[model samples]
Target: MWNKLFVDHPRTVQESYGEHAVMAASFGGRMVLAGLACLVHAVVPGLFVRTGSRTITVLYDEMVVNRNRKANKAAGEVAAVGGR
Candidate 1:
């Protein structure tokens, strides 16, 4: 996202933030989200913060999905062919 801003007229390191309030807000929101994610991880193992404490195991049926190697290999092959 920050790459979009400096694609042409790159901002001076010492004076960039002074000219861009939206960039400052974007960075602030990103930091807050990261901090919150860390806090959630500390309290819940394998629980996704964005998914509201939902266990990854439950979300993807990891108990069954992760165990079948043939299924995983097939999925990978499909993804490679599909250009995903």
Candidate 2:
């Protein structure tokens, strides 16, 4: 049960438990900071004009693009071995 609840998703993403925890925490922290920047920008137009969007782009690249690339590479490796 514990493995299913905690390890499965992390392993699927090619990260160990600690690594996944750190990555998730980092993403959460960045998102919170970005949200705060957006809130401030909402009140004051001059401040943080591009901070929120930039943060979103960076996070997307790190979390989605990189993860997809890793998954694809692993899949390709498995396919190559299977085909051989």
Candidate 3:
């Protein structure tokens, strides 16, 4: 199932650099590394799923109020500075 999600592509720009065996090899390596990263990203979410009802709603609401207060203070300070 997971194998179908990963689609690999070759590095085409490297081929234009030089007509040499080493360049092609490095291009292939880059493609492999990119493919590996994509595969890891796809599978990682399933592996690290936090299974539970989130109970931080009140805390988040408090944080929003705190953030608003701080923003208002900063804006007031900016206005005072500009006024002077």
Extract clashing residue pairs from model 1.
none
In model 2, where do residues sit more than 4 Å from their true spots? none
Q: For each candidate, C-alpha RMSD in Å?
A: 14.3, 1.8, 18.7
Per-structure clash totals for the candidates? 0, 0, 0
**Better candidate by lDDT, 1 or 2:** 2
lDDT of each candidate versus the true structure? 0.54, 0.94, 0.49
Writing each residue's lDDT as its tens digit, candidate 3 over 1-84 gives: 442332221122212223434544654665565556556656785631332112133334644675587678778999999999
> Which tens-of-lDDT digit does each residue in 1-84 have in candidate 2?
999999999998998999999999999999999999999999999999999999999999888886898889999999999999
Q: What TM-score, over all chains together, does every model reach?
A: 0.35, 0.80, 0.35
Residue 4 accuracy (lDDT) in model 3: 33
**Cα lDDT over the full model 1:** 0.54
Candidate ranking (lDDT, best to worst): 2, 1, 3
Segments of candidate 1 deviating more than 4 angstroms? 1-11, 14-19, 49-84
